[model samples]
Target chain A: MKAKVTVRLKSGVLDPQGRAVQHAAESLGLQGIQEIRLGKVFDIELETTDETEIEKILETLATKILANPVMENYEWEIIQS
Target chain B: MKAKVTVRLKSGVLDPQGRAVQHAAESLGLQGIQEIRLGKVFDIELETTDETEIEKILETLATKILANPVMENYEWEIIQS
Candidate 1:
């Protein structure tokens, strides 16, 4: 099975990287941009194809290591191939 | 208007971060993982709602700022809200 996990900072958390990118865009003459937020995406492959196994693995990945629960939220989905 | 841009490393490029993550997962006793790759996501908001404007902006953002053409591939889509 293949899967994708997205981890993003919570609304109230400070995103200095995003702010820097916004400033860089402005410097390049890009206009009308109000905000930019950044996140991480992980593409994973597994040896097993069982749905139940995938679910358990994804939950553990997202909650335990992929995200900081206090400051970020994470979501995962299996990729159909 | 809002858009999301995903920037991922080209298939042939070495992804040390991904390897590190995989190793970490293994250290945590998670098994059956074959591979892991890392990517970036940008959530952007603009003042203009025009489709043409959004397209132009997204193209610029993905190509010029968010992704390095030589090493990464990027795709973007508008978020309906």
Candidate 2:
């Protein structure tokens, strides 16, 4: 199975990198870019073919290591490739 | 339109952060984690309702800012929410 996980700052959390990007965007003369939130993505390729198993693995990974539950949020999908 | 952008090291590109994460995973006794790659994701909220326009914007962002064309790869999806 192929999995892609994205971990991001929670809605109210502060993101310094995103802020830097936002500042850069402003400098580039781009307007209407009100906010920017940065996150991390992990792309994994595995041999498993079961969706349920992949989901379980992702759940454990997310809860244990992929995200800081208090300040971050994560979402993932099983890539079919 | 809302967009979620993910940028990562192209295959064969060296990633220090990914190496660090792999080391951390090994320290945690994770098995079968042969490799680890790290990427960035951006969750963007926009007031516009057009997907075509969002795609154009994302293309520009990916090429001009979100990724380093030489060694990085990027993909994005428009989020309905």
lDDT tens digits, residue span B1-81, model 2: 678888989998998877777677567765455566888888776667778777877777778888998999898898887
* CAPRI grade of model 2: medium
Point out where model 1 deviates above 4 Å.
none
Worst 10 residues of 1 chain B by lDDT: B20-29
TM-score: model 2 vs. ground truth: 0.85
DockQ of 1: 0.87
What overall lDDT goes with each candidate model? 0.93, 0.79
How close is chain B to the truth by TM-score, in each candidate?
0.96, 0.92
- Count of clashes, each model: 0, 1
Native-referenced Cα lDDT, model 2: 0.79
- Segments in model 2 whose C-alpha atoms lie over 4 Å from true places: A47-53
On residues B1-81, what C-alpha lDDT tens digit does candidate 1 reach at each position? Answer: 899999999999999999998998888889999999999999999999998999999999888899999999999999876
